[model samples]
Target: EDKVVQSPLSLVVHEGDTVTLNCSYEVTNFRSLLWYKQEKKAPTFLFMLTSSGIEKKSGRLSSILDKKELFSILNITATQTGDSAIYLCAVFNSGNTGKLIFGQGTTLQVKP
Candidate 1:
């Protein structure tokens, strides 16, 4: 069975602070590692890492994969209160089943 683990299950930070979140996984026939942010009921896709040594970035957020180590990291810079949310990491197989094995998620609270 595929599994994902996220470190620092929860975090509290003030505006302008930067944070780093981590995810590690063990899976058979791993296809990709995906990052998502959840503010409400739905989760919004942030990045999908299929190749190692590639960093994906969007505005104040960025993520990178280390396939050799079977891990990934997510970074948030100049954090605002709006950045408060639950960040999730998931892994799925290469069989194209559209099934994802999700991590417990990291809850971030950004306060002004």
Candidate 2:
């Protein structure tokens, strides 16, 4: 069975603090892993890591994938109170099913 797990299910931090969120997964015919940030209604796309060791960055957020170890990490630097939200990790398999398996997600709260 395919599964994904995220560590530190919830976190509390002050503004300007840097945080590292972890996601590990096991899936059949792995394709890629994606990260998203959910604040109010919709979850915004953050990063998609495909190749191992190659990091994907967007503004203050960055993520990297490790295909061999079957894990990924998302890093946010100089966080702001507005950054508080639920972060989701999802995996896509190489099957034609076109399904995205998601983790329970990590809730992050940044204090001002």
Candidate 3:
């Protein structure tokens, strides 16, 4: 079965700390990788990476995909208390179903 795994299931850091979150996967007919951040409401789209080695960025958050290694990393620099949330990683297969296989997610707590 296709699966995705995230490391350091949970993390706690003081404000201004930089963090690296990992996501690895094993799937058939890989298509793209996606990252999301969930707060009080819903998961918010962060980045979608299709090409390996290309880093996608938004504000202090950035992510890169390494297809050959079957993994991806999300980096957050100078994090703030507002950055506390659940970070999710998901992948889409090349199949026509358009369904995304998701990992359990990494919960982050940024203290002030």
**Poorly placed runs, candidate 3 (over 4 Å):** none
lDDT of 2 by residue, 1-112 (tens): 8999998899999999999999999998888999999999999998887899999999999999999999999999999999999999999987878688999999999999
Inter-residue clash pairs, candidate 3: none
> Which run of 10 residues does model 2 get worst, by summed lDDT?
92-101
Q: Assess candidate 2 and give its TM-score to the true structure.
A: 0.97
RMSD of 3: 0.8
User: What's the distance in Å from true for residue 108, model 2?
Assistant: 0.2
Stretches > 4 Å off in candidate 1: 95-98
Off by over 4 Å in 2: none
Candidates' C-alpha lDDT: 0.94, 0.94, 0.95
Q: On residues 1-112, what C-alpha lDDT tens digit does candidate 1 reach at each position?
A: 6789999899999999999999999988888999999998899999999999989999999999999999999999999999999999998876657578899999999999
**How much does candidate 1 score in TM-score?**
0.95
Error of 1 at 95 (Å): 4.2
For all predicted structures, in order, the TM-scores are 0.95, 0.97, 0.97
- Candidate ranking under TM-score, highest first, comes to 2, 3, 1
- Residue 82, candidate 3: C-alpha displacement in angstroms: 0.5
Writing each residue's lDDT as its tens digit, candidate 3 over 1-112 gives 8899998799999999999999999988899999999998899999999999999989999999999999999999999999999999999988777689999999999999
